[model samples]
Target: MSNSIATWMGKGHAAVEAPIGDDGFCFGSEPSLADVCLIPQLYAARRFEVPLDACPRILRVEELAGRHEVFGSAHPSVQPDAE
Candidate 1:
């Protein structure tokens, strides 16, 4: 979580890679809830400190997701206006 956001910090960035399961996995595939759970926690992770460069794949997914409407609605800053 914390690690995911730091990748966006720019100059000071470092990616944190996670282990693909022994079941065999690779980069650039459909993400799981594990990926879904990352972005918000990344906010907190930035507040603290987490390495990013270790996980370039996750960050790439983060960027790709950001371009989608679904991701936009899910973001706290994009919440619906109160009725």
Candidate 2:
């Protein structure tokens, strides 16, 4: 699954144009439908120890999202079911 996700994200990275801002979100400056979808996948990929060195754009979006309150609150580590 991790390998598959890595491949999927690799394709997403190559298909997406460069971000307009310093952060590499696929859409506008704020998190959009693309981010809502991608961030969770990226989080899950990390849990499975998928190496992300190949997707710098995705990595940049992940970093920026990690700093936001909405994403932070929804993170697996902070979820009510976390253990």
Candidate 3:
């Protein structure tokens, strides 16, 4: 599972390289479906302890997303159902 998640995130990291631009989110200036999907995958990767040292773009995305209220508040650590 860890290897799979790492590979998937690596692909995602490559995909966002050119398109992410200065705004940070995957499509245009605001968060889109791509960002929405990417955020959760990142959470899953972290939860599973998948190393992300090589996926700088993904790490950047995760960092920026972590600052958004809508996204930040939904993190597993802060969620009401989290254990």
lDDT of each: 0.53, 0.73, 0.74
For model 1 the local lDDT of residue 79 reads 69
Q: Candidate 3 — which residues are off by over 4 angstroms?
A: 1-19
Q: Which stretches of candidate 1 lie over 4 Å from their true place?
A: 1-16, 20-28, 49-51, 80-83
Best-matching candidate per TM-score: 2
Question: Against the true structure, candidate 2 has what lDDT?
Answer: 0.73
Highest-lDDT candidate:
3
For residues 1-83, write the lDDT of model 2, one tens digit per residue: 56787777666555642543555565668888888787887777677666677667777888889988998998888988998
Per-residue CA lDDT of model 1 for 1-83, tens digit only, reads 44445545533333223443322112335546655666665545545676455556556666756766676778766667623
* Candidate 2 off by > 4 Å: 1-24
lDDT of 1 at 18: 45
Question: How big is the RMSD of model 2?
Answer: 2.9
Candidate 3 on 1-83: residue-level lDDT in tens?
56887777667666666566655776665777888888887777677777678666667777878888999887778888889
Cα lDDT of candidate 1 equals 0.53
All candidates in order of lDDT, best leading: 3, 2, 1
| Candidate 3 lDDT | 0.74
TM-score of each: 0.50, 0.72, 0.71
